[model samples]
Target: MSNIKKIVDIGDKELEVWKSGKGRTIIILPGMMSSLAEWELLYEELSKEARVIIYYRAGYGKSDKGKIPRNCTENAKDLYALMKKLRITSPIIIGHSYGGLILQEFVMKYPNEASEIILVDSTSYGAHKLDEVEIEEEDGSSTEAWVEKCKIYSSLSKEVLQVEMAEWITEMKKNLSSSQHLEVEEFMSNPVMFESLSEELEHDLLTCGETNQHKSFPNTSTIVIGRDPKASITEMVESEGLHRSEAEEIELIWQTLILNQTKLNYKTTYIMAEGSGHSVHLEKPEVIKKAVDSILNSTEVED
Candidate 1:
């Protein structure tokens, strides 16, 4: 049975989590607004070699939201505090999407906390490069109304974001005209919040510039996967329409501009899933599992 324990006494609410396995310590952090349970199937495969630690962020999962910071920096701090409390030394860190950004920040703040880091089709460019997508309201007012709509249509959009479907595209288009635009301006304005989160991401890229340390992590057996440019998909709601070319460019930004900025300590294996889109893990779980397995077993890996 999967063991899930709420971590208490820590400043920020976190959880002590794992399935079953023993060897290296692997810590798994899911995407933003996601729960640790998201790893249900992935854990089955990864736990075969090492103990997997999947914790719920403060605002996510069973963890309470009070007193917990939602941005990336605070999120990383929470993970660090949890590790210290649990007495985990040099555990391997694995992050997906926003989770990846948190780990990336943590690594910069505390470079030696992990024996290795694995990024699974994650967003690394930070808020600056993140696609500013918004939904317009009927009254021509721009608000997080889109995210609110998302919360309402969570069940359906969840599948759409994870797996590309024509219906989702159609629904998104239906709202475009009546919807108002909300840019990242609001998200970027919170310095104590947003800027702090972005700093770590910028540092990671900066570190890469001084030295192509990308190979170093890989030498330590760290692995990273980039989304396929060709298979990328974007949904434009209402009046918004994502042309095939634009979607492909988005993938290129991640692979060519964002991810490529890092010079790995070891040879990084870049695999592109032709059939998959942004959410590669959901679109192709088997492929993700295979990649994870290979990295875990490879002799080049340290932890």
Candidate 2:
């Protein structure tokens, strides 16, 4: 992988943008709390075929904390500005998880600036309606209520914050080597990381609402890669005190929502990444590369 990196001044803040390889640009947007480093494997593979543009979203990695609202529209605006400043137009966009929502907004806002889009285990508008699930909380409220109550994390000390986020860190470590673990640890130590996560979580509903306002996607080739809901059924059942049947039902609903997301565009394809949960790109980078290659090859043929 090349080590070329630069800072782009995006009005409110400077974003750390990394670019490598050559040919058509493939701009990658990371999920909430996910940094550009998480895209290392896929970036290396895709960069071999085309120019890969990955950046640290504001408040992640080497980027400055942003002042804009942490909603999908604002995030898309930042990306549009960055691409304009970099003189990149009509590039392929790949969004993972929350990044998927941002990409939806981007295509909606810019309409004609994207050649194609790939969504990796992305959040769906139907899934955004958390009220459909009846997972009760300690306060007799639903899981959505608990999520709203727990959004304030900016004031926690580093030690406490680390403990709170230990589960995910442990999961990430399972896939990383010692050096990678150390790098992840250093990134997690940044207080801004937690703050940014909190901001995103707090405004998640608003982001979905904004995204819903757009009725159609731009006329572009699109791929929606969804995770196997079965892979996460056990965890969901245990954590939410759900019965086996209930968990299975919820899983079905989740999968359905993911499938329905493809309806936003006429030219759309859906693929299920079996055995991979939400982080399909991390769990199955090769699958992502195949999808990307297919898109790039098709683009080549069209040109």
The CA lDDT at 108 in model 1 is 67
For each candidate, give its TM-score against the true structure: 0.64, 0.87
Compared with the true structure, what per-residue lDDT tens digits does model 2 show for residues 219-254?
A: 778999988777768766665567777677777877
Q: Candidate 1's error at 230, in angstroms?
A: 1.9
- Regions of candidate 2 where Cα sits further than 4 Å from its true position: 136-151, 163-167, 206-211, 234-242
RMSD of each: 9.8, 2.8
Best by TM-score: 2
Give residue 217's lDDT in candidate 2 (0 to 100): 71
Error of 2 at 229 (Å): 3.0
Which 10 consecutive residues of model 1 have the lowest summed lDDT?
180-189
Candidate 1 deviant stretches above 4 angstroms: 5-8, 12-18, 66-68, 130-221, 234-241, 261-269, 299-303
lDDT of 2 at 250: 70
Kindly give the number of clashing pairs for every candidate.
24, 0
Each prediction's Cα lDDT score? 0.54, 0.76
Which residue pairs clash within candidate 2? none
For candidate 1, lDDT tens digit of each residue in 1-303? 555454554654544444467767778887743434445567767777678778766544335444532456667788888888878897778788767767766776676788767777765643334343332333322223333333333334333333433443343333222221111121112122222223333343323233322422324445676666655554322123555555455445567643552455554455665566656556666766776667567635653
